[model samples]
Target: MVQEKQSDRQQRLDNFLQAVEAAQKVQDDIMKYGLEAAHLYCDDIDGDWLETWEEDEDGQQSFVELVTNFLQSDDLVAVKVRKQLKDKSLQEIAVNLEKCLSLSEEDDRIFAVKKVLLRGVAVAESNRGTSSDEIDEIELLDLAEELLDKLAEFLVSINR
Candidate 1:
């Protein structure tokens, strides 16, 4: 039944869309409301992930593959980062960006978010010319969440 259901293009598209939105929300929750808010957001990401489609032997165009392809072609994150960051490490910033949704492993997103947060903090400290252990757990979570949200938006823009 699940396999049969996965074959429907419309269903797949819908699932892809929902996944993008849910992933965005998780980023939002982690960023705006607080890291504790992530507990609420994590429950929402229920859809296909991009890595899964690429790993399959058949190389079929699952909804995730289709969405990810469109996203890369559109280059949504490049425009987004340019607008959001005034920091000097924009080039390195690009490298720090990570994918937000992973249907097979939701917890993985949190780790990705942490990497983004650390990168941002490093950039920020360099820009400010100061170094201190003033890291707030909630704030770090928030930065990760915002980046994830932006990336998810980039992924969805492929549909548009």
Candidate 2:
């Protein structure tokens, strides 16, 4: 019985490792796709506009892909709820924003909130859009500011 239990534990560990590997692969794919999209957008729009943005071609690609996949998957609605919960914590600051806002249980708003929050965290933690630990102090600060602005905007939108 002890041997069987040990075998079962080992099997579960193997399964968890496989799941982690799969998740990593998915993340890599998302980043690649998002970067391509950013590059295209940069080519068409102002590259300079994206320059100050926290997400580099790669980071943007990852974010976009993750968001897209999350939205399309079974977890779509749940992701939104998570964003709203996060946003709710920022209600005080959001109340002061000038933009006309409206509340929605809609998937889009939740997705937007998640993106903003992720971007903010990414900027704060890594100080770079594409990858962490690659950015200078000034760049990181700038990205954090931008992310905060977006977060505020998202919160305001949802509050209304």
Candidate 3:
């Protein structure tokens, strides 16, 4: 019976590890495709007017497709993991924030901004209502704004 119990525990551990690995792979793929699409879009925009214009349509279409697939797959995995975890630990929240800031477009950046802000508000409210820990709501809001600014700057540099 003890041996059987041990084997069952091991199997559960193995399953958890596999799930984490799968989640990481999804995150990596999302970043890879997102960055690639950003690069392609940036390149097609920042060049001689006629040359860039000629290639813009096809490049934009390809970039859009890549981004669409990445978002759908990555968001699905993210939602699943977030649901499973229930509480978003600081590390997990940071990872998601980083991914959001890496997006190149204003609309994409806004999505990330909204996510972080929403998370911050939720965290703050929960903490305030429950415990007396000094949770700095202003700090959390500042961090989100900083991320948005950094992403905007990066995008501007790509355009220039």
Candidate 4:
């Protein structure tokens, strides 16, 4: 029994270390490419996901699709954050953003990644709450800027 327990623990530790290494690789990618680095982890994204904000006659992507993609992503960061924050309302999302900001201040790489994903979730939730008419052109632009700022902060944190 003791030997079996020891073996199990060793296996668990090995899996954890492997996960950490993979997360570090992801952090390196994020450092190099900012938020666009998501494409690196998400090669399986479909044609719909490729659609941009622009209104091309052949393709159309809404905020709903983007948010759904984030929620469904299998990337380590997204998976971990989804496990941590199941269903967040706009107000809860604000609290999570503040928590993420605090976590980002830490020196840990894992925390940095977690904070970035948390912020992403918060932004997605905020966007999900809005109707097309409720959020005018300016609000959409502002949201994009805010996402960029969060990505910049995340890159800085990981670089440190």
Candidate 5:
């Protein structure tokens, strides 16, 4: 039982790290390519994810369909959320943003399902939450880092 628990924690850690790296790439892509290219990126923050998926075949190509669906679905959701926040008050804005987090959880679960199908293990942490809209690049990056920190903490607790 102990061994199984440790293994689960390790798997979750690996998955979390991979996601953080992916999120970081998304941020960098937006910063480097500008938001205009975001469409080319298929809703990947700026365009980092699309570039990574296209250029990096280390293990992503095999899951092209999965990644594409995740990106596009997420991007579509982002577009809608951006529109809804146009008239919300400060408090309402926060609530509306929280409604947008289904995509993140969707992305994570899709990745985890793929991993489980291939490796017989589900490593992705199932987390879901919403966020505010029109968040600038720096804010997006900070949010990404905050998520990474939170995931790492989850990993630590699971390890025990």
Candidate 6:
């Protein structure tokens, strides 16, 4: 009985360690990419912009062959960097919003609030017809700061 209990504890510990490692890897990817990742999360566009579709008459190409052909034709490096950027940005927004709301990371409302803030950014910049990704570094910094300030104010007012 003691051995069985020990084995169960060991399994739980191993599962926890695996979870930590996975989270660390995700954090590393986000750090390498930046907040651009968050902007992409709110974007309505599909990442399939890089894909090409062809009608196969006989469908002679096996799935593996089609995958190989696609991989050979696609600029995987660029796509990866773009996807990573989106993830990083999303992480940044999640962290900041969590701080702003004094909420835990696991709170589901964080996702909804992040989307609302991104919409605010879009509405503010709609006059220029430029998306957040198109904004230069300085502009992005200023815009982010401004959005956060406004959000803080809005949050404060609702508590009154």
lDDT of each: 0.56, 0.45, 0.54, 0.53, 0.43, 0.48
lDDT of 3 by residue, 39-101 (tens): 544555555766445234334422223332333344543343343335555355545655776
Question: All candidates' TM-scores?
Answer: 0.35, 0.23, 0.27, 0.30, 0.26, 0.25
Q: How many residue pairs clash in each candidate?
A: 1, 5, 0, 0, 3, 7
Rank the models by TM-score, top first: 1, 4, 3, 5, 6, 2
Model 2 TM-score is 0.23
Q: Write the per-residue lDDT of candidate 5 for residues 1-160, one digit (tens) a residue.
A: 9999999999999999999998998888888888765765565565466556643345433223333232234454333333323333333433322333334574553443222222211111111132323225454344334433433443354334
- Among all windows of 10 consecutive residues in model 6, the one with the lowest summed lDDT is 77-86
Stretches off by above 4 angstroms in model 2 are: 35-160
Tally clashes: model 5.
3
Error of 3 at 104 (Å): 4.2
The digit string of per-residue lDDT tens for model 2 on 10-45 reads 999999999999788667766879656445334556
Output the lDDT of residue 77, model 2: 44
Give the per-residue Cα lDDT of candidate 4 at 112: 43
lDDT of 2 at 120: 42
Worst 10 residues of 2 by lDDT: 92-101
lDDT of 4 by residue, 1-160 (tens): 9999999999999999999999999999999999889888887555564446443454543333333444456755445445435664434533444444444443343354445445555665575784435424453344434443544454454444
The candidate that achieves the highest TM-score relative to the unseen native structure: 1
Name the TM-score of candidate 6.
Answer: 0.25
> Could you tell me which residue pairs clash in candidate 5?
97-131, 98-130, 98-131
